[model samples]
Target: MVVLAVIIGLIFWVTSDDSGKNTANSTDLSGTPSYALPSAYSDPSASASGVPGVSGGSSGGGGGNAAAPGESPAPGEPGIPGGTPAGETPQPVPASGLCPDQNISVVLYTDKPAYVEGEQPIFTIAVTNAGLSECTRDVGKAMQSVTVLNLAGDRRIWASGDCAPVEGVNNQLLKPGQQVKDTIDWSGTTSTPGCETVRQPVAPGAYQAVARIGEKASAPITFNVNRPAAQ
Candidate 1:
């Protein structure tokens, strides 16, 4: 009888142990009964769609970094300056807007057609813009000069540049039909290049005056220099 009772007690204990373990495992994994979980936790797709911007939807209907409207792209990016694309070179702006020579007309002028020996002669350089647009040039004393050539126009006698030259940068913009004039006085003395030779007073005779600016020379103009007694 004792053996029989021991067998029954062992079977009952095993059955109760199995039942308790099954109940604990099922209830623990079934989830918290006191707190409710979000729908995203149950449905995997809800996690992607419920949160904003997490989805693969972006500008152009695709997933990539897109600049917002009215926002400029960062520099050094593709298609930005400094990394300019081929055949799209940026044009450089010039400091001096110089005009073409064909558009500029350099006309020479003298204060008078006659002067007395030992008298100072005045020469005027008139530069006019003959083009339809505005342009620039350096008309400073550094680029201007006057020369008195023999009637033959082959020999150069006196020149404004023979002495100390005027200096400065006088860049000027000229409009169509606009004219600028500059004046220089002649000492009526002959001088060599670089003022290397002692200058001598020129002889009384008919002389030609020519004005120059940069590489442009004026047409020779006729003028006379006579002895002071004849004036």
Candidate 2:
């Protein structure tokens, strides 16, 4: 009776231990609970549709950079990179007046069919300042003058008292469009004939004496002078 009771007690103890071990193992194998898991955990492709730019969908369609899919490209600007256009010519500037703003008029006159080695030749030169606006009236009768130049010789000669002024023949103020005349008498000597003969004074060669009007602005007039026959 005592042995049977001990055996029964041992069998009960082994079965209870095995049942406890099986229950603990099953609990461990079941894994984490769904309620405790993060709801956001998922694959990128799993979502219904991707965000526009973030998902690599067609971006802004503009020409450069990352433009949207439906957008148009910008127009190109014009340029003149190489050079000026062909067959283009620049125009020249025309001459204004005789002396810009000054309403001044200058004229020269002389006799033609000139004589050779003759008396002093006479000429007339006229200078007119249209008005005070044209002429500097401030120039007193003293300043009112004329200058004659030998263009060929590059020489200059003047006569302030000999000519008319801007005002009267003696007045300095030259009114608008007023005219004044100067008579010049240029003499010719044996030493300086018109342009007849050459070779005598200094250089023995055919030389001609020439006279010009308006300080040589006018064309020069020439005449001949014959050399004396050999002794």
Candidate 3:
């Protein structure tokens, strides 16, 4: 009976030892410790931003949601990244396709270079498109100016804009070598800065007429206003 018990004890000890060895070798099969999961195993629905199914970075592996190099935003869209909101239309960009200021020329002329006192001054402004291609310009009162200055060009005596309200913008497309002209009759009287009211008639003297558009001005044309001879 003692020998049989000894054999049974040896068999049991051997079986227990083999079971522990199998458990240690099985780690490679699961690729994870029994107490913890692998680092790569994460919830499929969760993202870094804490939003489900929505990723933080760019799609297609480009890294971020920015326009590609050398690409511009479509018109009416934000000009730069993180600019205008998604739906708001952006302001139009000024076009440089039109002719430059150097391609335009202005000329001021009057019906009579010498005017008798109390005679209305009939003036004309001529603008020529001297460019090689067609271009557009604002020919409205807002962009046009006619000024009368003293012979020395030191004193401004009158201006077309003083009493006139610039109604609206008039953009005209001018062909190359084309000319545009306008005429106005000025009261032979001085005016204040605002032209709110006409001042006294200008004294008999030599004066200059100047036509201007923005910073561009025509060559000054001289004229004389003389008192009428007594009958």
Query: Tens-digit lDDT track for model 3 on 38-97?
Result: 457566667856566778664575544567689984456456666643432222223755
lDDT of each: 0.80, 0.43, 0.80
> Is 2 or 3 the stronger prediction by TM-score?
3
Candidate 1, residues 15-126, lDDT tens digits: the string is 9999999999998988856776665354555444567557644347654455689987555546646865343222222446686666667778788889888998888899
Per-residue lDDT value at 175 in model 1: 80
Per-residue lDDT value at 153 in model 1: 88
Error of 2 at 172 (Å): 4.1
Best by TM-score: 1
Q: 209 in model 1: Cα distance from truth in Å?
A: 1.5
| Regions of candidate 3 where Cα sits further than 4 Å from its true position | 1-96, 196-198
Q: Model 2 over residues 63-114: C-alpha lDDT tens digits? A: 6564458977555587767965352132221243122222444455555434
Ranking by TM-score: 1, 3, 2
Q: Can you tell me which runs of candidate 2 are displaced by over 4 Å?
A: 1-103, 130-169, 190-231
Q: If scored against the real structure, what TM-score would every candidate get?
A: 0.57, 0.28, 0.56
